[model samples]
Every structure is written in C-alpha cells, then in structure tokens.
Target: MGKRIRVGMADLNICSAPDSIITLGLGSCVGIILYDRVSKKCGMLHAMLPDSTKIRNNGLRAKFVDTGLEDLLAMLEKEGVRRSSLVAKVAGGATMFNFSSSSEISGIGDRNVDAARECLKKYNISIIAEDTGKDYGRTVEFYPETGKFEIRAVGRDVTFI
Candidate 1:
C-alpha cells in the first residue's frame, strides 16, 4: 500500500506513483486532480471558490480555482511532469441547499465546477471524468499510479471518475 497524503479544504498536494492523495468535506468546494501518466505524478486541489478576485481575502491561494490550478501546474512542471501529459478529473461541487432567492453564495457549487472546467481548458488540459452536483458532501481519494479517482459520500455508492 502506498502512502496516502491528505489534502485539506482549500489546500493542495502532489504525490508520485505508488502513493495517493485525498481530500474531504467537499460540498460547495471542488476537488481538481491532475495526473501525468508517464511520470506517475499526481496533484489534487480542493478549491472553495471560483475566482479569487471576487473575494476580499484570498485565504490559502488554493481556495480558489483560478489561482490554485495555475499554481498546481507549476508545481507539477517543477516535478518534471510534462504539460502535454497532464490529464484532469474533478469531484464535489454540490448545491447542498435550496434558496428561493438565489445569490452568488447559492450558486457557488456550479461556479466552482465552471471555474474548474474553464481554467483547465485555458491550460489545454483535458478533464477525463467528474462526479459533481447534488445536495451532499463528498470525500475523494486519487491514486496516480493507476489513475483511479474514487469518490465517497454519505448514503451514496462509491463512485470512480
């Protein structure tokens, strides 16, 4: 069994093959995972918001999709992962509530997913799979060696993306 690195909310981490990465309590947040098959390098980011500019304080930098993915790509490149070999998968981004008068906060989950997609596309990175949207929270575990993304949620079946 490889070491499992835990990535907290609004946090990011990278690992190599034979190892894995995980994150938990992803409600409105989005977990973006990237893998470079050739190098067996993987990265995961738990982003809470879509755009950092929309917020007054950009907490952990990894809390926003736009900023976090840019930083993650750089980290992977630094680890000798080629840009062309990077592929992505995403999970989380649940509505989690029902509001009559919707505000930006109410739409956070969708926005996070949009940001994850847009930002990944901006970098020409293809997203291979996703498990998102609903009224529940999720925990995600990803193994780079096998490129397996496992998603677990309360009262729901384990899903692989």
Candidate 2:
C-alpha cells in the first residue's frame, strides 16, 4: 500500500501515489495540489501568505505563496515527476475575517488567490479545477492516480477541486 501524507498549516509535501496528500483548515490560506496522471505522483502545499519577499527568515518560507509553490515543485521533480505531466488544482483562499476597512488582513485571501494564479501561470501549469474565495475554511484531498480532488468547505457543498 502507498503512504498517506498529511500537510499542516504553512507546510508542503509531495508524494508518488493517489490518496497520498491531504491538507486542512485553510482559512485565508491556499492549498495547491499538483498531480501527474501518468506517473500518479502528487504534491500539496498550504500557504498562509501571498509572498515571501517581506519575510527575511526561512522559518516561514512555507507560509508564503511564491516560495511554497517553488519548493513543492522542486520536491516533486526530485521524485521523478515531470513538469509537463503535472495538472494543478487549488482550494481555499477564503475570506474568513470581516472588516469594515480595506487592510492587508482583510485582503489576504484575495492576494493569496492572485499570487497563486500568477505563480501557476509562470510555471506553465494549467489549473484543472479550483474551489476558492468564500467566507469559510476548507479541507482538501487529492488522489493523484485518478487526478481527482475533493474539497470540503464549511456551510457549503463539498466540491471536486
């Protein structure tokens, strides 16, 4: 049997099998899932911040969108997953907090979504599906073998990412 990998907040992981990656509690955060259909390899990242340019420390690298996506892609490449075979799926980036004024905290979710989209485009990876931008949190599951994703959000329907 293949192993099951769980990715926590501000964390990233890559696997070579279906049902190998899962992440939860994405509130104003993003979960990026990359799957290779031919090889059945998968990778998942949970990023809390839109970019890492402001952070000088490496401790929070996984929390940033740019660095997190790069790391996840490199890890998958090391596992013999080719870039051309990778199909992307994303979830989360929900606006969990309500604010009366425009501020960084209030727009974090939107920024995260935009950053993710730009990064994926830069990598030339097409996003096959996504469940993003609401007012709740979400949990995501990826099955690489079939390139299927299951996304569950609070007070909303469970969607196939």
Please give the RMSD to the true structure for each candidate, in Å.
Answer: 1.1, 1.6
Q: How accurate locally is residue 147 in candidate 1, as Cα lDDT from 0 to 100?
A: 92
Candidate 1 has an lDDT of 0.91
The list of candidate 2 runs beyond 4 A from truth reads none
102-130 in candidate 1: lDDT tens per residue?
Answer: 88778989989999999999999999999
The number of clashing residue pairs in model 2 is 0
Instruction: In angstroms, give how far residue 60 of model 1 lies from its true place.
Output: 2.7
Off by over 4 Å in 1: none
lDDT score for residue 66 of model 2:
95
> Compared to the true structure, candidate 1 yields what TM-score?
0.96
Give the RMSD in angstroms, all C-alphas superposed, for model 1.
1.1
